[model samples]
Target chain A: MERRVKLLGTGKYLPARVVTAAELDEQLGLATGWTEKKSGVRIRHYVTTETAAQMGAIAAKRAAEAAGVSLQELDCIVCASGTAQQEIPCTAALIQEELGLSRTGIPCFDINSTCLSFVTALDVMSCAMAAGVYKRVLIVSTEIASMGLNWKQKESCVLFGDGAAAVVVGQTPEGESSRIISSAMQTYSEGAHYSEIRGGGTMVHPRHYANGHEDDFAFDMDGRKIFRLTSQLITGFVDSLLAKASVSKKQLQAVIPHQASGMALRIMRTKLGFMEQQMVDIMADHGNVIAASIPMALHEAISQKRVARGDCLLLLGTSAGLSLGGIVLEY
Target chain B: MERRVKLLGTGKYLPARVVTAAELDEQLGLATGWTEKKSGVRIRHYVTTETAAQMGAIAAKRAAEAAGVSLQELDCIVCASGTAQQEIPCTAALIQEELGLSRTGIPCFDINSTCLSFVTALDVMSCAMAAGVYKRVLIVSTEIASMGLNWKQKESCVLFGDGAAAVVVGQTPEGESSRIISSAMQTYSEGAHYSEIRGGGTMVHPRHYANGHEDDFAFDMDGRKIFRLTSQLITGFVDSLLAKASVSKKQLQAVIPHQASGMALRIMRTKLGFMEQQMVDIMADHGNVIAASIPMALHEAISQKRVARGDCLLLLGTSAGLSLGGIVLEY
Candidate 1:
């Protein structure tokens, strides 16, 4: 029989400093209500001093504590972020160092699928745990999109915030309290360039930084295009994913989708047949925290007692690779 | 029962343009034969027109063809690289696009543990396959360290080259073929900063690039520090790793280690008590291909018939996270 993967606990960290949509609109000279009306965001946390890895460490510590698992017991750590604190040593390593788990010799790495990174990493950690490669896996998603912001791109800039979320996953015997059912991920790269930051990699080496456009160095988005494309495909995608999980919509006690945008969430709520009360929506206050979106929302849902033991929760989202991912599990 | 994960095929792509140590020594005005004696690297490939994703795609196609698997059969592509082509959409997505495998809805992501990235990803793919998360998986490691080279840092610059290696992994029924018997990875973050590119991240945002130092944007290394640390613990690390697999030197047919450096390889050959022929040494001609080193070396060993079916093979290496990783398998 396949070993069951269980989520032991969840934690989230939001920076204390807040950047309201109004503040950004005023700063970028946009219409006063444009950010809120368009994206369903009022205010979002923006990091003032805490870095991505730093915030991730805080969230991870809380996760480990909540799980009643010591940091030393985590056999693996996966930092599933679209961005990094640095490109060389991986943000996971830095977070390991920050959490005082450095030198303990546990394996650490990063998995990136942009916004879907959390779900991608969840499935990865699940598979590994189920196969006995690791007993306990710590997964963290921290995105500091504020630093990658392009002031000129008011749309993308105002939509992103800085935050982190973490979860502790472990293998449980059959007939356990909670266990993952099935997970599916699909990517369509035709929209790969729809949301990107072109300057952070070898394609546009740092040597050319002096002459690079701010947009190349910052996040850029064709929000409408992404919405249109995903809207066209999400229904079939979700239906297929639910079928793979052998789950019906009526059985889903809570749906934690990526808090991508106000309109995207609205479409998921309406066109996708999810009740407003069934979905976790934290984008209004947190904005879209990139890879951290879904996990943070899950943490909120759990804390709010929206999902309980014996309940089935569906976590799903869209990512920058034009990737769609979903995971169903009994909580 | 847990499925067995086996290597289906391997392929590699080396750029057409070759740069010899003599040429580099002359170009950089180093002492005569300095590059050769210091690093024992005579020649290395340097890409002129190709990017990391382009070379990776070529390698991926070759791997898929060798495995007799069509692109459509690939369920996942894990780009296990030390560097990415871009920071946003992921190198795997770009490679998927280059390979004409785009819009297929197969999941694409990355696993990064720097130079040990390939082995780390191999274990990841292995576990996922064993758990039946995927029937077929493709893992690629493509590094273009030359782009991040600092011409002034002759020591580090001459030790790196550009290349890519690809491997197709799949699960077979219990009765036939090679299988991953065991895998173990350990990390010590005390040395995380010993080798790094301090730029290209949120730490040194691209917007502040114009004022960044050349070293910040380029790869930096303290070779002696790494050697000192590793040499102090290499023997114990190897012994512990072997014990985990319950295998000994007498049971091993061949070993594939990361092409780190001439001195490092020599130490492994001598102190580790491996015969010259037992270890695959490709550093002299390839320098270090970063994450591509071990897989590329394995490709050469396979083609040379140094490792064949039913033989016990060991894949092991150290990475920038001061990580020691190993996998033992029946080949």
Candidate 2:
């Protein structure tokens, strides 16, 4: 029996402050328009007082409200952020606390595979719902790239943003069956070094913090290398995923991909033969929000009615693991 | 219509170097036998040439071999460590890279709720298997606690070790119905600060390394606080979990709680009415391996014939999130 799942509601939270390319370039002493031409991100949001957990809480509350459910009704919370605010308690637990629902006693944990986390988390939540282990699973993806970006790395720093997105997952209504039709993941760890932050972990202790390389503590990327590798790998990944689900690109009402870069999205759109309108690209405004990008874009698509009831949606992304993931589901 | 899950096999890898309490005491200028009296940890393993991902890969291979499956046959790999080797590209991805399985592309990710991670990973894997999304899953728990231990804090420094444990999971074949009967988790974020390492995460930037507090950059613990809280809350957690599973403590053939401390286990056994023989404790030799403790203990129990086929096994633990978790399964 194929288990069905539905997005009861979707929500996103962007920080109040938006930084334009001109402002960033001016601050960094780079030429104006450099960020836009290089990364295709004109403006991106940055949190001033807001934290990752706080943004996630706001997104969660909105999702719960839209789902027509109270916070206490969530059977589980899965946090899929690329970065966590702390190392001790999982971010999901903190998010629960931030939402004022701390003692509700639902199982809270985190699933991280870097940028692919949200899509991967969706797979885990889908399976949990299918097995009747959870009636409603709340998945939250929040990233604060602003704090970790190396201002010196113009290529990556300009392309990143901070935000959060969330969804309340549950079974489809009795008469309707909105199930995850298929999913697939392909990890090529050879490209693991393409994007990484080696510090802020055991491999590079704070005791040796003074021995830091310029890029070790902050997010860094070999943009050209990753672009080349991803462009080569993404086609097979998407094809195999579609074949597994027996889904066709022509059948999809919308394709929500990781808002990685303007150039990357163009490659994806052109290669997949997806129409300009069919592909949802919010990168110019939101930039690459790391793991938060996909669901945030999905929330926007749904809110704008670009996606509606009975629409077929495809979510895909390339993560820091050099991993490619895709999920085919009915809205 | 309960979905059944079975332990296909288990494996463990302890680092080559073993550090005795006397050695640590002398190195840290502590009185001899101080560690033994306080934590009941006599000896613990420390890594020299081995890294977390390397040890994890070795354990994973053994688990796959024992299960009569090749690494390639596994549908997914979930690394459930409290601390990551690096911040980006999760430890699971790194393990995949090390095992020479870089491009095989099965879904790989990490789940963490601190020490309860293995048990939590089991729940996630069981649900995935039950839903038929994955036929076989590999779960790895590895900790490099040695690298983060605060040598000045003798209470916590001597209580931890470095090791890895892996398990191969799948459905019980044919007529056998061994499966996860039930489980439960409770997180109290009020105690979230009871034990934590504030550095090596987004909460503390490496740039602030020079401003490190005496305890901020390394593992610090309020041992008495955690012990007191666990003693107060564990009996209810175990009871609630067993009740939901419709089982009794008397039916459990073996209980493998996290090898946190000899003291914590004693409190658990006394409060839960579990016999000394019913529980497995390897803390004296292995010390507390953080997230790797429970599975490593289970691996030892199975290898030593303390637990066998048809035995009702219970896995449980207290984690840094001030979370309590348990799983009842007949193996």
Per-residue lDDT of A119-192 in model 2, one digit per residue for the tens? 98999878878877788999999998887898877878889999999999988889996889888777888888
* Candidate 1 iRMSD, 1 decimal: 1.9
Candidate 2 backbone collisions, by pair: none
- Per residue, candidate 1 scores C-alpha lDDT tens digits across B104-150 of 98888889989999988888878778777788999999998888887
| Steric clashes per prediction | 0, 0
Which sections of candidate 1 miss by over 4 Å? Answer: A1-3, A173-175, B1-3
Residue pairs in collision within model 1: none
* Candidate 2: CAPRI quality band: medium
Could you estimate the TM-score for every candidate? 0.98, 0.97
What are the lDDT scores of the predictions, listed in order? 0.86, 0.86
lDDT, residue A60, candidate 1: 96
User: Native contacts retained by model 2, as a fraction?
Assistant: 0.70
| lDDT per residue as tens, model 1, A1-331 | 1348778889999999998888877888889899888778999998989988899999999998988999999999899998988878888888888988777988888889999999989887787887778899999999988888877777677788999999998877566757778888888888888888887787788767677455577777898889888988899988987887888998999999999888789888898898888989998999999999999999999898888877999999998887888888887
Candidate 2's residue-wise lDDT over B219-247, tens digit each? 77888888888788888888888888888
For candidate 1, the per-residue lDDT at A292 reads 96
